[model samples]
Target chain A: MTAAAPPLLTVEHLTMRFGGLVAINDLSFTARQRQITAIIGPNGAGKTTVFNCLTGFYKPSVGRLTLTPPNNGGCFLLERMEGFRIAKDAGVARTFQNIRLFAGMSVLENLVVAQHNRLMRASAYSVAGLLGLNRYTRAERQAVELARYWLDRIELTGQADWAAGNLPYGSQRRLEIARAMCTEPCLLCLDEPAAGLNPRESAQLNELLLDIRGQHGIGLLLIEHDMSVVMQISDHVVVLDHGAPIAEGTPDMVSNDPAVIRAYLGAAEGEALPPDVAGGLPTAPPC
Target chain B: MLKDALAAAVVAALLALPLLGFRLADSQQGLSLDYRFAWVGYAAAAVFIGRLGMAFAAAAFSRVFQRKRQTLLPLAGRPSRNRKIVGWLLVAAALLLPLAPFADRNLIDKATLLLIYVMLGWGLNIVVGLAGLLDLGYVAFYAVGAYSYALLSQTFGLSFWLCLPFAGALAACFGILLGFPVLRLRGDYLAIVTLGFGEIVRVVLLNWESLTNGPNGISGIQRPSFFGLPFLAAAPGRTTFHEFFGLPFSPGQRIIFLYYVILVLALATNLFTLRIRRLPIGRAWEALREDETACRSLGINPTRTKLSAFALGAMFAGFAGSFFATRQGFISPESFTFIESAIILAIVVLGGMGSQIGIVLAAILLVGLPEWFRDLQQYRMLAFGGAMVLIMLWRPRGLLASREPTIRLAADALEAAPQTAGEAAR
Candidate 1:
């Protein structure tokens, strides 16, 4: 991917405090257009807090979060906007760390719900829709088409009619991603998308994320504990420890950085690196 | 199992102690205590035997039923085609009820009452079932509708037909008014606020003597006429309904007319709800019910979605309340109380939330059965309470727990659309 264009989303000096505790401290990063940016950190490093701030779930105690859409539809100061407006007007969609599909609804219904604003307009505030008018029908058919497209992409076409809660864990995760994609976001934020997946499912998720970024040209911001996924698919990586950024660079540069190693291994001087960290980068320079 | 039986015996003894073990009697010699040990022993024995028999019966029943569970419970969860057929059959029966040979004035009255509850159930279903808002004071809307019609018709000498829409609009306004303050609350807190709102409405109706006539209530409320013709034996200047129809003046004719009026009203409520369930607003309600935060993430304004549910639900309840006031020819604070709301809420809950037909079944069971067994007046509520408990134990999810999605994909939608179009053409 080229780096000439301005970044799609920029987070600068973000800080979030809960009472006496600081969850995210002076975090800064950038996610370029059509590129995958992974934020990796040990537990309690405030990676998820950064995501919450960017997505407007939390108003950071201090920060300027900006998003420049490809269409040049004016940058959105996300910190000043409400969460739903950030998703709706700014075209930013996100999935929860824990799967939050409308579990009682069918898989297809979950996807259709993501397109609620479009459908609501097509229905003209439901006046025409209740009458079963042609225009409303056309809009509804288009929505079904878009939903089907995402379902096919997610390989959940066969499970479209099943209640989303009844799906297997991996399938639920994929469906959550598909549901977020149905919103047609410019920036997709995923928190721990591969948390409970097995190795095979995790690899598939990596391919899916890569495919989404490459095909749709949507920016991807991922917070993941799975080192293998973070190292394999990310174009840029940011490492955080104790609520602060420790390293930021391309995957290779950050993986081999000594500061990143010490952050993961708890500052031990001579201990051997964990297998996940060692295996993530097969060829690392001796420290 | 033995321990359970022993516990049951002990519980029975405790229960019997107050009733049988000691009794105080006032006579010429003053108070005297009587011990009824025989009654206590018999109660304990009955409890022990009943407990043992229930255990054995349950074991045997499960052993027999569990073997061929799939075959025996073919319609347990998935009732796609069969459910539709049953629904149509029910509608047909209800429509033909007034014309049935066995129909009598008493039966028609009971059926009308049942239909009113059915309408209320469908209305509350929008808020409680679809939007997952626990409104404990639904009867406030009902009271608003009834009082609106009663006050309008009496004060302005307006006809029932003219006041009906006004009543409904007033109730909807009240719904929105109540909705705003409770928008941020959920679950139990919402329920308590709603309950308080209901009591407030009832209390206002009781205390507002100048407008509501206090506890005396408003009587001689005008009944709904057939168009402009009143259903009277004779009119001085205008022709009565019986005279216009050139039929003998039988009181049953008016009862039958009232039944059809409410029947149409209730069916309209059902049709409107069914149609709205497929619309965007309806989907928004269901989505909000599932997850409010997820709904917001998808750009759905929770306030608007929840308000729509409340207003629409209240509107329908208003329609029913107008019918109620007109039918009874009276309006009072006593009619709309917390117990009324509780019964309506129970119908929705026991009917399985969001299931239209389930509401009808539950209303019939909860309302109709108790009315039918009114001869057992002392034990009526006891039996009703016991039935509710038994139903909860047996089907905790509700009588009709299986849900059918409102939306389908292209493959199913295409198939469904063509068939409906063909039916329309036919």
Candidate 2:
């Protein structure tokens, strides 16, 4: 409600369906500014589907998905915008669950391409772009320079010319993030960024996420199953199951929630925990 | 090693024949400064240089320049500040080389023709390679361009230079029109539509007697003059271009001047294409080519991107066509056949899609080799076809295969990545 503390993106009662299937059901959540938020659950728990909705891949069947800009300028109903426009206008960028990169292009080109819409806007100046124009060349040089700047940020200057598809699995994952970062979005949604990463790579990804949040002033909405990554990096955690949020709180809170425990850790694990305050010893943190 | 050397030797010899002892229309002996050989040689040189240069440049660039990749004549790398100055110096030297005392006029002509094909290849490269849209009827635009120039120049007595832009615009309009109807098709279906479009244009040219002068085609089309001087060996009353330049009157002089004109145009095409390729529009083309669905997700209207590709390609073809009419001093539908389209497609495919150097090489091989084998006339096509089949089998991707896929994300994200890096390294 307050101008100073605008939630970056707010989705209220969002539902998406495919014929008889409900992928996301009555889901409501908010990604606050400058925080690492994690959505975690078992497979088919609709963690990715939530990301899809935020990124405008799947339009919600019902309810409003408002992306309130940082300064509370105007809210964007994300469902109203198409995928690319969502990224461009709403400043919402997302990485796929699996690494998706222009493998044929250079690592540098991949990052540069993410900023395509920006360049297109600059070139809209007619004569400057046509007639073998001079003004357009200057703008084009700047785009290349910016692309170079991102490549440096990701520590990928050495492999800038290498095809993106050829990078190591972990490197490709990082490149995807760097690419999403190139668009300079207000909120970055990452889907299973650490899926196949080794411990070191996963740790590296965590550091990147924190850097993205701290230095870039970008909010991260990550869907990660890696407990260490989620627990260590996330400022807030939302636990989902079967297209519904089961628990929403801090990492410690969601980890201890009875419903989260039953759904993720299983019913047997939940039943073993004592209900008495003194006996349970630890209470879950607040949402 | 011996076999490789022999093959290389044969190619070099075949390329040099025009300079050494070939004949052009009998009066000119020692390598005909014809468009066919010029285009062929230009492309061969681009590929030969691109592949070899990649290796050597990669090593030198890494050592001298603290850059990420080795790109000698890179498709994307900006030269260092010092290198930029040096590059311009080299460009100046190249421009002046033809004026050098030692430079052969035939060499100049060949170089000029190479420049023209480069433009055509660069143009075709946009639609077929960058956009991943097959256009089997590109020559139709070439015909449109030639006819536009021919008709306008003849009717209005407009100069070739003045009519060039008009020719390009006319062809571009047709390109966009073709793009709209074919929007619903994909792959082979799209190819079929474009092929049909090309055939329709040719048929119209052949049948439209009132306008196109029917099957005999438009003749006595004026040859472009240098300034106001006509390039003739003997004109009864007036000073020909040769006498105006104070050179001994020779037929070779005219061929040389046309070569330079085409060279300039071709170079312009190359520069234009290079500039465009680095733009966001070029990247968008690559994206659309890779995955139309993802491109839409990115808010790039596929219809627009495709139309741009079609229009840009057609514009260049038109430019080529106008020059073609000027060069031949004639115009006809016979030159705009499906076979011509196929050859151009073959050049793009053989060169490697979206690869400028590769396409040039392919064009040179396809066009020049056939001419070189003219002694074996009937067997020439058989050799060309067999070579194409063999190259496809060996490279499968093409002669100079592209390893980097345009689209990164797809149905199989897992499989596409390794291929990307592996091809670059290879």
True contacts kept of each: 0.50, 0.19
Q: Model 2, A153-264: lDDT tens per residue? A: 6666556656666577878888888887878888888888998989988988888899889888878899886777888888888877888888898777777677876665
Q: Cα miss at B404, model 2 (Å)?
A: 12
Chain A only: TM-score per candidate: 0.93, 0.88
TM-score of 2: 0.73
Give per-residue lDDT, candidate 2, residue B284.
Answer: 80
What DockQ would you assign to candidate 1?
A: 0.43
Stretches of model 1 off by over 4 angstroms after superposition: A267-276, A279-287, B60-79, B410-426
Clashes of each: 0, 13
RMSD of each: 5.3, 12.0
